[model samples]
Target: MLHLKDGLSFKPGLSDLGALASHYTVVFLLLTHTCGGQSDPQPMVAMAGDDVILPCHLETAADASDMTVAWTRPDLSPKFVHVRRDRMDFLINQNPLYQGRTSVFNSKLKRGDLSVKLYRVKLSDGGTYSCFIPDLDKESTVQLVVGQWILRSLDLFNAAF
Candidate 1:
């Protein structure tokens, strides 16, 4: 004999299953009513010259060695400030203005790394730099900020006085 225990819920018998199924159907229908959809997350945010890392992910297993990866200051004429091609040490097409500076931290391409390092970052470098991964047809950008204040105070005055 099946006994109904106190505070314990039991599955309804086949005869009551129709009612149970209808109850579930009603709940599912209620939840399916949409309110709205979500927006895509912004790709990049700015940081001071403390070295900002632009995040990018690979979508393909194809060779990125011959892919044309470009990083540009988008505010201007889409100037090709930096172009990386092949796995042999990314070539800095060197904007006449960016001379004596700008190096890449790009490591092994097979492992899918495409990071660039800007050295002694200046105020003019405070803009968006986009890295285009053609193999995946994806672009990731990072904003750079330059600050005037030094993090540490000098001890020159104590030595002199």
Candidate 2:
């Protein structure tokens, strides 16, 4: 069984699919810390199809201009949604669906923040997003939910079903 932090155990071997379905459950755990790490938490909540801001706040006084910062979706692990360099603008090298609709908060970046603003949100965009900055010991995540897009996806799913 693959034991997850959320009390979910995905058994590799199962007699029946129905039996396996009953074993999945979600558990919430509160995690707290007092220190230095490569990431921080910046959450964003927005209506589907509307723009939203995912803030990446660097709490400490860290000089991050030399670091390579990237915002990616964890669901699509190892895929970068957007990338930014020390002197370059936000570049959309991957994920064509996200082109022309994402940018970083300039004011925040000037203040050691690396938050990103996503426009024309889609249901597929709803997932755990992360900002990773190398060498500042920094990485942060923000949860995104595209409600309207989700509803639409669900409708399509049901119709297919």
| Best-matching candidate per TM-score | 2
Instruction: Name the regions of candidate 2 deviating beyond 4 angstroms.
Output: 1-44, 61-63, 90-92, 149-161
The segments of candidate 1 whose C-alpha lies over 4 angstroms from its true place after superposition are 1-55, 59-63, 88-93, 150-161
Best by lDDT, which number?
A: 2
Q: List clashing residue pairs in candidate 1.
A: none
* Ten contiguous residues minimizing lDDT sum, candidate 1: 27-36
The per-residue C-alpha lDDT of model 2 at residue 153 equals: 35
* Deviation from truth (RMSD, Å), model 1: 21.2
Task: Give candidate 1's error at residue 123 in angstroms.
Answer: 1.0
Model 1 lDDT, full chain set: 0.48
- What lDDT does the true structure give each of the candidates? 0.48, 0.61
TM-score of each: 0.51, 0.59
